[model samples]
Target: GSKVVITSVPRVMVEGFLKEYLSVGHVIGTELHTFGCYFTGFLTSSGLVVRHRALDDYFGDRKPDIGIGTSSLYDHLFISSCKVSLNLGPMF
Candidate 1:
């Protein structure tokens, strides 16, 4: 009797392909503030740009502040940024 072996694709390779096919560039900038973390980068191959930010704290998770009056607004901005970046173009 004989047996056969199989191989599977690696996660990193898949992620790399997706990132490149998705036109995601190397993460060039990152900033973390009291409110959240901001990421900035350019899709080098397609010439598209992106800016992303994620809030550190959830709505009503902490004492209200003039700076944090509207958590929904920030959430919207973050979501829009991601959507726009991901759908900006068809990768070659």
Candidate 2:
């Protein structure tokens, strides 16, 4: 079985949009610190995109066959755990 997990540190609310737009089943993004309807512009916890801890929490008992990343260092935390990894480089 294969799974598409988007491990980013954007915001949890975006998970729904990404799931529908990209058709991915899982999303692991950072939780934004907010007060009422206002955003504090900071993370409630730590960023997930560049942290290996996020990967650990996301894929506890299972491992992905491949990992797609953007950098050699930051993204590699998630990439290195997979059987294979790909660096897509900068989006621009």
Candidate 3:
């Protein structure tokens, strides 16, 4: 089976929905601050997650098979990196 990964939303926020509804296998989102099994609803020390950087880290040297997103600004960065990309936006 092809691995489906979504890496733009906060993991703690949309992980369940993505998995259940979208059948997403992996999600790389903003890391929330946690203490002893408690979420702080705050970003981690590393700060806000950069989309392009995250994509580079996730893919390394292997370009992804596909990239899909709604945002043109942030999503466009990685979408172009994939072999195939779909921008679900009005402009696209």
Q: If scored against the real structure, what TM-score would every candidate get? A: 0.18, 0.71, 0.75
Off by over 4 Å in 3: 1-4, 21-23, 35-37
Q: List runs of model 2 lying over 4 Å from the truth.
A: 1-4, 46-50, 90-92
Better of 2 and 3 by lDDT: 3
Quick one: RMSD of model 1?
A: 20.4
Among these predictions, the greatest lDDT belongs to 3
Tens digit of lDDT per residue, candidate 2, span 1-92? 53466555575668778778877776776677889998887877664464466667767866778888877577777788877889898661
Candidate that scores best on TM-score: 3
1-92: candidate 3 lDDT, tens digit per residue: 45656464567898888788988787778888998899988888877777778878877998888887766677878788889988898565
What TM-score should be assigned to candidate 1?
Answer: 0.18
Residue-pair clashes per candidate, as listed? 0, 0, 0
Q: Which residue runs does candidate 1 get wrong by more than 4 Å? A: 1-14, 27-77, 80-92
Angstrom error at residue 28, model 3: 0.8
Question: For candidate 1, lDDT tens digit of each residue in 2-60?
Answer: 11111122223344554566554332222222224432332223232122221222222
lDDT: worst 10-residue window of model 3: 1-10
Number of clashes found in candidate 3: 0
